[model samples]
Target chain A: MIKFSINKAFFLQALNATKRAISSKNAIPILSSLKIEVNSQSITLTGSNGQISIENTISAKEENAGLLVTSSGAILLEANFFINIVSSLPDITLDFEEIDQHQVVLNSGKSEITLKGKDVEQYPRLQEVGTNNPLILETKLLKTIISETAFAASTQESRPILTGIHLVLTNHKEFKAVATDSHRMSQRKLTLDHSSDNFDVVIPSRSLREFAAVFTDDIESVEVFFSSSQILFRSEYISFYTRLLEGNYPDTDRLLVNNFETEVVFNTNALRYAMERAHLISNATQNGTVKLEVINNQVTAHVNSPEVGKVNEELDTESLSGNDLTISFNPTYLIEALKALKSETVTIRFISPIRPFTLIPSDDNENFIQLITPVRTN
Target chain B: MIKFSINKAFFLQALNATKRAISSKNAIPILSSLKIEVNSQSITLTGSNGQISIENTISAKEENAGLLVTSSGAILLEANFFINIVSSLPDITLDFEEIDQHQVVLNSGKSEITLKGKDVEQYPRLQEVGTNNPLILETKLLKTIISETAFAASTQESRPILTGIHLVLTNHKEFKAVATDSHRMSQRKLTLDHSSDNFDVVIPSRSLREFAAVFTDDIESVEVFFSSSQILFRSEYISFYTRLLEGNYPDTDRLLVNNFETEVVFNTNALRYAMERAHLISNATQNGTVKLEVINNQVTAHVNSPEVGKVNEELDTESLSGNDLTISFNPTYLIEALKALKSETVTIRFISPIRPFTLIPSDDNENFIQLITPVRTN
Candidate 1:
């Protein structure tokens, strides 16, 4: 049994953070309970699954001396319901005491609840990945790279390697992340101020996404550690870990081309608006095609479905410099690319009618590249 | 061919409003299209289903008018895709011309395409609901009443009459709305400065909800007209009609008791927070019972489920003037009642453990009352 008094606001935040560490599956009942231990100066909470675990400690002012050691024990309680009650309780003092061999009493003010708990010995321990020289990078830059490239990872289970983003760190300050679904690809580059030896690893996109969601508070830097088969991200208070996919990523550098015969520059907002309109009709069909016709000085968007008719709109263009080209591609790709772009105007370069096109920022300073392969239309 | 040009923003808003007038079913294809008719000074767009129809006209400037009447005709175009394309186009002059017997060319600069059009004569005519001396009420007030009372209406189809909220207007410048689903009930009252003859009507909650969504611009008053089987809400720019559900609504007046044996007052926020926590566990069970125990000066919420465990919370109360009572009711009902309250404190009146209880604003000047029936718990 553990008893402690904690600041209500601070405790609520810490509980929320710890709750995300537990999984909902009851396959391992002990894994769902939050382990609480009180010391002289602070209370510590540890939540873990077999693969990953998060430990959070909040410091408190002690009113009694010698740690007050009323009880120092661990009990497994239901996670979902426990988090809800803790966040709603009005009082800051949480009285936790064991009632029977397996039942625990939790009291806050006039409210009292008895919950069944599992033994601490059944809970799995978290494995530590050797962090001899963890690479440190800005948290915001890492988050940006993950968001931009993670969406392109293949969601299919047939190819397990394609579901994870390939990360390669050159020296200590420069890194590249790439994700692809075979048909389309996205890549981003980030430069860090810290230095380390060159390292290469692949982390599952799902785990990376979950980490980004839980780390809402902005931090200056994050330390990344990797073992032979796993990766870990360590911040100030939480460490996120995931198993790495075992396979060699396909060579994709040769696929990107710098040459282009046709190029069109337009406002990202205008292009997005046009594509949104076309999507309304094309979305009903399986292929969802939107055709772009570019001539000497103008461009037109034509969206058609034999069953639902067609829509044509001439969107204003900034400039068009290239041979007259009519290209048809999936509109969904263009919409997503435009959404990721930060600049007002975007320049799209096309190699040929059948080749993949590149979407780059018009300002030419950002080192981001998004490529989309066009679908062949008969 | 019907050809005209109007402000794209103005046109888009009118189209969006009229699109809601179209029915999803294709029983009559013409009903899915907006009929555009060009006159000397204005262009009228009409979209209709058998039950409801909306017509909006946009006046053209003197210079914009060529009476360009090469041909006066009507055509039926698909509503969904047309509205999307028109709204997305950049703010520019739109030229519409008929290319052939069944095709219309819509061009704005280089973006031009010919779309197939259906004969306008195939469209269904709008049904006219006769009106007598219609009553006028503030739009904001009506919207508030609908939002506060509509959620309590029965969603089940077995009791058709319970799916609508009963609205009664009295000559004493007062309007009342009531809704119930047998388990819970909500009632709201508003006083109007304008006098009108007493009228009672039942309007479908869904229709009122849709009407409220389309009413973006606030107006001083809205004219309401009632027919034998239909009710019409006429704003300055749009007229919405809904068919009344046919049946005799159960008399709920007798269910409300003026006096109670015990009354308890608590902060709305505190009670709401406690109920939300209790619901976290009770929601897992079918009965969804949350036991409320009001004693000397405290109220405790207890929710127990053998399958998912139990939760108990003792909530602080401002005052408890009623005799000790233990009652169990659906926590969802109380949640909805708390949401409808506008005051900081709410007063709950109880007469018996099994009878319906009343929750009203702690302040005597507020005129909203909610009733919830207690479930029999063994």
Candidate 2:
């Protein structure tokens, strides 16, 4: 039996964090339950959906937790139903007690709720990732890296390997993260002050995104551990675990372009607005395309759909050089790349009208770059 | 040629108001376009989807409109496309000009867009609602009345008459609006200061809800006019028109019960909170029912869902008299009825466990009342 009283607000927050990993539809009935274990000093809540699991612990030592435990035990309850009940409780503090096997009662003010609990033994045990050698990084830096590269990952299951972001640590000093969907690629590299064994792993893009969303500003840094088939991202009060994709990532080093016949510089905001307007028309056409033309020092972007009319705009370019060229490509790829760059000014280098192009921040080093393959418009 | 220059923000607002009536799919091709008529003094934009139509006019006399008409003419443009183009323009002001018989050009900053225009003569004429005698009421009052009675109307189409709210002006003095869906009913009555023609009509609940949404606080009063098959609500700068439902509304006067064996008074907000909590569990069950018991002047609300558990709460009642009783009902109906009441304290009078009950504001005159039928659970 388990019995405890805790602050409503504090418990609700913990439940929400763990709820992110709980999918509504569960292949295993017990997987839809949330496992809650209470000890003399703390309470832990765990929720899992097979692919990903989240666990949050609130320590009694923390003044705001307001935790009082009469006994120590573990139990499981329906995830969504329990959360809603807690959310609708009327008082500041709620008392929980397990009077019999598979029976639990909750009292908050004049409201009393009784729920059927599942057996804790029925839940799958959480996979353990070895923490012998952990990689430590700033939470904000990790969030930024995920945002910059994850969007390029393929969403289709046909190429399962491309649906994951590749992370590699080389020479125990350099770290890099890359994602690509054949048509576009994003790479981010950074130097580390301290590292352990060099390893390479592919984490599913969806799992990485979820991990980044759960990271709050108060979590200054996170520790990551990798096993053969599982990865864990751990903070002070939370642990996030996900299964690693079992496949080799494609070699993307040779895909980066160096030689260029045409180059242009543009204000990020100005170019984005023009692309958005052109997208309005191109988006309506079948296999729509937005074309860009460079003449002398002026550049113009235009989209023509016979049925919906046409739109043309003079781009606000910062500078231009090399041979003047005209190129047509999918506008959506460039728009998303620009948003991820988060820069004031961007530099674009093109090899040919048909070759892939590269975009980099004009004010920073080339450590971060994105590549987009142009469409062959004849 | 139709040519004009106007402030972008002012024009966008007008387009949005008119766009509310334009449906994505239209039986008549021309109905997908918005008609624009510009004279020397004003420009009117109209959009219709057969059932309802909305028109907004911008006058040159309004300083903020910044309307500078180069010429007076009329034309039609695809509603959604034109709205999106105007929204994406970069400058504060946009210039529009008709270059040919079926083509138009819009210039804003460095962006130029050309769109195909349709003949304005192909668009259906706006049905006129004679202004010979108009009944005027405060916009706020009309909004309140719509909210108070519209939710009780039936959403199902099998009974067409119940899907509309019956509005009647008796002897050109008393104004009453009532709606019922067989299981529940809401009625609101008021007196008009000045008299007009006595008439009765049934307006579709959906149209009134949409018309109410477009009314802003700036519109102090609305003038309403009724025709044989249509009704129009007109303000100084905007007009909304909708077709009336053709059917005889069922008489609901006999459904209102005046005597009861049990009476209970409760604070509206406190009871609503309890009901919401009870609804959480009852909502999960098939054909869920929430049961309320009154005994010795104390009330308890409970819901028992075998699979999801049960919740019981002691309600904070203001007063109780008469007899003890227990009743079961569909919580959704009561929840919605309470929301529409918007009262501080409500008095609930029950005739019996199986008979419908009435709720009225305990502190104010009985001008607004809502009745709910009980669910029979043996």
- The candidate that wins on lDDT is 2
lDDT of 2 by residue, B1-378 (tens): 888999999999999999989986899889989999999999999999998999899999999999999898999999999999999999999999988766888999999988888989999987888876899989999999999999999999999989999999998989999999999999998989999888899999999998887878789999999999999999999999999999899988888868899989989878887888889889877778899999888899989888878898999889898989999998888888888877799999999999999999887646898899999987
Task: Report lDDT (Cα) of residue B81, candidate 2.
Answer: 91
Over 4 Å off in model 2, which ranges? none
Candidate 2's C-alpha lDDT? 0.90
- What is the per-residue lDDT of model 2 for residues A207-278, given as tens digits with 9 covering 90 to 100? 999988787878999998999999989998899999999988999999985889988999988888888888
DockQ of every candidate structure: 0.39, 0.83
| Strongest candidate by TM-score | 2
Q: Give the per-residue Cα lDDT of candidate 2 at B108.
A: 96
> What's the TM-score of each model vs. the native?
0.87, 0.98
Kindly provide the TM-score of model 1 when superposed on the true structure, using C-alpha atoms.
Answer: 0.87
Q: How displaced is residue A323 in candidate 2, in Å? A: 1.1
Q: What are the lDDT scores of the predictions, listed in order?
A: 0.76, 0.90
